[model samples]
Every structure is written in C-alpha cells, then in structure tokens.
Target: MSTYKKYFAAMALIWAGCAVVIILAYLLLFAPQSRRRLQTENQLKETKRAYRAGLKAGQKDAQDLAREQIQQMQHGLANFVTDAESSANLIFDLSQIANARQLDSFTIKAKDDREKSEMSDYKNIGENHIDVSFTGDFNQFATFLNAMERHQPVIFVDQFKITRPKRQGTANNVNMSLAVFVRKNNES
Candidate 1:
C-alpha cells in the first residue's frame, strides 16, 4: 500500500474508536443520571397528587363532622323550653304522674334564687330546681320515677332520700331534689 493511503486509513480508524468511546461514556454515565432525574421528577409529581387528594378528603371529613354536630345541637334545642310557665307545666305533669302511680302524698317546692344563680352562667340556659316529697309503696315509687323519666320535659334527679316508718304496713317516704333544664332567650 502507498504511505499516504495507509496514513489516511489509520486516521479513519482512530476517529471511529473515539466515536465509540464517546457513545459508551454517554450510555454508562449520562444516560443513567438522566433516567434517575426523570424518575425523581415523576415521584415528586405523584407525591403532590396524593397530598392534594388527602387534603381534600380530610376537609370533607371535617365538614361532615361539623354538620352532624350542628344537627345534634338543633335537636337538643328543639326539646328545650324557655319560659317559667312551661316549667310550672312540667311540675304539674309530675303531680299528675304521682296521681297515676297512686302515691299517698306528693308535694313539690321551688328552690331558692341563690341556687338558680349558679347554673345561669351558660348562655341562654336556665335550670329549674324543685324539692319533691312523696309517700308510696316500692312498686308505686318505681313506676312514678319511670314515668317522670319518660315525661316530655327532661327531669334530672339531683339527690334522693327514702325512709320507711318503724311501724309495719306504712308506706315509705321519698324526698328528692330535681333539676330541669330550659333554654332562654339571649337577653344580652
């Protein structure tokens, strides 16, 4: 071969080898790094999407809970009364209940103003306090208490005392302090 042709052939071979080395370096080093960067970006996008979905679900859950609580409060408000006349009517209902149970004697008295003041701190809420005394057999007393519990106005028994006369064949006496809750108009 001619020397000029040989030199040209050697130069072409060297150029081809450099090209292969560059391609291999790119595949081995730069390609993997670019793949990793693409994967990291995809993961970040997925994380952001999941975070947004979770936030929306949490907001919906909180709204549902708030709605449920508001409904309960509305129901409670419906059952509450606001006036003295209604309180007296509830007491009259109690007397009728005692009559139905055939209690020997039933009496009720209102509590003092000092006692009512302590419970009036809650907004638009008031409590009616009464001392009740009755005389009846055990079965009749149980029926009377159950009737009171089932009555329209809610009654709470605060304290109770029962006594049996020393003499046989006498009815037992019961004394109880009761509190009934009522809702009042917001006065200021």
Candidate 2:
C-alpha cells in the first residue's frame, strides 16, 4: 500500500477506539443512573394513586358514621315520646278501671316496698306499689279484674282477696282487697 493510505487507516482506527471507550463508559455509569430515575418515577405515580384511593375510602366512612348517628338520635326521641304518652294513658286507664268495676268505695294506697334495712323496714328506692280496696259483689270484682287485664296500660295484679264483711251484722256487703303494680310517677 502507499504511505497516504496507511496514514488514513491509522486515523480511522484511533477514532473507532475513542468511540468504543465513550460507549463503554456510558454503559457502566450513566445507564444504571437512568434506570434508577425511571424506577423512582414509577414509585411516585403508584403513591399518588394510593393516596387518592385512601381519601375516597375515608370520605365514605365519614358519611356512613354520620347517618348512623342521626338514626340513633331519631330512635331515642321516638322512645321518649312513647314513654310520655304511655304514662298519661296509664293514669286515665286506672280511673276507668275504678268506674267500670262498679266498686262501692275504692281506696288506692301507694306504699314503697323497697327495704332499707331488716331492722327498720325503710325503703331505699322509695318507689310505691298500689293497693285497691273496695266493698263489692263477686261478679263486680271479676269484671274489674278482667277490665284491668284488657286495659291498654300495663297493670300487674300481684295479690287479691275476697272475704265476708266482719262487723256487727252486715251480711249484704263483702270486703275485697286488690294489690296491683302501678308505674312510678317519676318514671320516664
């Protein structure tokens, strides 16, 4: 070959070697850095998506909790009104029971039966039971018992007794004692 051709070939070889060295340096150093940058970008996107989903779930839970509280308040108010109406109805029913039973003379005695101590026989809670006494016929007493049971208000007849009048000489009248449970006046 000629001398000029040999010089041209050497120049080409030097240029090619420089290009290979540069490419190898980039592969060893910058390539790993670029891969790490891509991984970081993907992680950031996943985190943003997760945050949005968590926020939506939190909002749904708050709404469900608020609705539950409102329902509980409404139920409590309804119960209060029902209790007040029941108390008023109980009073009227008791008066009606007295009239319908055809009692000759009835007395309602309220006494608290809670025992404070065995020695003193004093009540602690001080709630009262009802004692209804009258002088009436057997049929009238039975009718009173039936009416008491049929009444709208709740009434528990705890004890009752029918006995002939114990006096000088009174045979037409009989003594009747009825013990019943009445709701306390202070009850809600």
Candidate 3:
C-alpha cells in the first residue's frame, strides 16, 4: 500500500517481463539457428565419412601391394596371365610334368572351368586353383613337385596328401591342391 513498496513491485515486474522477452527472443531466433548448426554438423560428418570410405575404396593398401609385388618377383615371370587362355597352359604344363614323371592315374581338374572370379583382390592379377592327383612312388612324386616348383613362372603347391592304395604295391596315391597366381597384364 506504501508508495515505495508499490514502486519496488513495479520494478520487479518489469525486470521479470524483460527476462521473459529475452528468453522468448532466444527461443525464437537462437534456437532455430542452433538446430540448423547441429544439422549442418551432422551433414558434414556424414560427408566426411563418405569421403573417407571412397578414399579407402579407391586406393590399394601399400603393404598388401608390396606383398603382391614380392610374390610376382618370386614367380620369375610377372606376365604370367592376361586372361583365362593365358593361364590355360598351367594345366598343360602340369600335364607335361606328370608325363615326364610317368605318374599313373595322373589326373588334373580345374576347380572352375571358367575365368577367374571377381573375388580376386587385384584387377590385373588373377588366381586359379586346380586339383591334381597322381599315382607314383614317393621319389617320383617328389621329383614331380620339384619340377612344378621349378617351372618358369613358378606354381604354388598349396598342399599334397599321400596315401598308399591297398591294391598298388609300392605306388602311392598323391592328391595335390595347387594355387596359381598370374598377372592379367603382360607389363610384368
């Protein structure tokens, strides 16, 4: 009821109104701006992720490339394959080695008659698999494998298992799994 108290109450009410107006202004203006900033940040993050993924997909890994080069160098001929026909001679060469060793039951079969699948990591390098089975004495089989390893471009013998058949006296059944890596480009 006193004039001073009335004046003080009016001041407090005005200050409170000003505070409410400021809060409303922030809610109307800064709030949307903050939301837009957050959206932009999220978009930027997504773009960066996509760009990183593209970079990863575009370039080959150095260590992996080095390992491939080393393998090719060891093969003695980097221009080992250009296409399916280029690698077809592997089967024939293996046949020759078997014939030279006089390996009986010498049978070679391609895992897939078609060309190398897209599973290969390198666009220019190709990989092929074959299952070679033969019957011969241990010595003959060893000689055959050495000859294959010594073949000009080098053939990788993944594995070989020898089992003696009951009927064959001293002959051993040799089952071999081979992995051949050849370059699709003659560039070596």
Best of the candidates, TM-score: 1
Quote the positional error of residue 184 for candidate 2 in Å. Answer: 8.8
Off by over 4 Å in 3: 1-83, 113-119, 185-188
> Would you list the rank order by TM-score, best first?
1, 3, 2
- lDDT for position 22 in model 3: 100
Per-residue lDDT over 1-188 for candidate 1, one digit per residue giving the tens place of the 0 to 100 score? 69999999999999999999999999999999999999999999999999987787579786798789999987776565436557778777888888888787799888866444666678767887888998888898788889878766668888888999889999899999988877766656
**Model 3: per-residue Cα lDDT at residue 63:** 56
For 1-188, candidate 2 gives per-residue lDDT tens digits of 69899999999999999999999999999999999999999999999999987786579786788789999986754432234335435545666787876677766654456445232433222122456677776778778778876654335565677777777444324333323322223533
TM-score on alpha carbons, each prediction:
0.59, 0.38, 0.51
lDDT of 3 at 157: 84
Q: For residue 135, what is the lDDT in candidate 2?
A: 75
In each prediction, how many residue pairs overlap at the backbone (N, C-alpha, C within less than 3 A)? 0, 0, 0
* Global lDDT scores for all candidate models: 0.82, 0.62, 0.81
